[model samples]
Target: MSGSDRRRGVIALREESCTVCMLCVRECPDWCITIDSHVERVPAEGPGGRPRTAHVLDRFDIDYALCLYCGICVEVCPFDALFWSPETDYAEPALGDLVHGKERLGEWLGSAPGAAQPDGQSASG
Candidate 1:
């Protein structure tokens, strides 16, 4: 896709870089991030099969209406799971429209725009 086809302002997750330390989970102040496990299928090239990987993210919700966008959670994430993106065209007419959960968080993970923080350097993961 071309650059114009992309989103302009938002926040997102970098899953591959996620260390699952749960710092964002704990520091959210909003109970946004929830840890969970799931079955993952490795690539067929390897001795692959469905294996249960601790997703660590049962949910990573953000209540935009209530979100001060303080970037507090972003700053506290040790694995760089929380980040700001230039894709903020979110629209919701009702208050309930602001309760974003796992699916939305995962969507951000799927199409964010940069590299995550390096592993091992600790902030709060």
Candidate 2:
């Protein structure tokens, strides 16, 4: 696929931008996105500020086996955490292996924007 065609290609995740919000999970018609997280107490960044609880992501996975490739998850993500990747060479020997964990999902993150892709869209995939 061409670089400009990532919207219809595979999915990539940016873990840093994700807030552990469940919008993608709840909005997915196929319920393919899986995430594991917990709340942590974050100390105030400055004096006279209040501490707050934050969701810490422990695990995040996407089951391509169940995904419809409908782009719903990508579109519904409030943060730009979910984006499309033009790399389509992913193939799993077993169906279970299609459940891509956060690390694998993030493999293509370097190809996110300004970088060129295998499709030569940017200049990174």
Candidate 3:
């Protein structure tokens, strides 16, 4: 495929940006995306303000063995934390190795395509 051609690439996750909303998990037809998070209370910004709770990501894994490459999870990510990485050559000797965690997914972010421009032009344009 040419450089401009879009590939049915692997999924890349930005764990820091993810809100752990479970939208991707619920939208995945193959049930390949797994996420675990916890709620933590943070001190109020002001004296009269109530404490705020934040979701801390504990675990995020995607079983490529079960994934259909349908991009449902990517589309359902409200936080834009999920992306399509063109580096799809992640073949492994063992089937278990195909199940990638957050670290592995994050690595792909380096090679993933940049975000589109607001004027509907490709980043390269």
Q: Which candidate ranks first by TM-score, i.e. highest?
A: 3
Tens-place lDDT digits, model 3, residues 11-77: 8877777898999999899888889999999899977999999999999999999999999888888
Arrange candidates, best TM-score first: 3, 2, 1
Sort by lDDT, best first: what order? Answer: 3, 2, 1
Clashing pairs in 2: 115-124, 116-123, 116-124, 117-124, 117-125
Which candidate has the top score in lDDT?
Answer: 3
Clashing residue pairs found in predicted model 1: 8-86, 8-87, 9-86, 9-87, 9-88, 10-87, 10-88, 23-125, 78-125
Q: Report the lDDT tens digits of candidate 2 across residue range 1-125.
A: 86565454578887877899889999999888889999999999898999999998889899989999998888898777787776677889999988988888788666555334435554222
* lDDT value, candidate 2, whole model: 0.80
Whole-model lDDT per candidate: 0.60, 0.80, 0.83
Stretches of candidate 2 off by over 4 Å are 1-7, 114-125
Tens-digit lDDT track of model 1 for 1-125: 99866534556766555666767657777664555545455444546545444454444567777665656777887666666666565778898787776566656644455533465332223
Residue 11 error, candidate 2, Å: 1.0
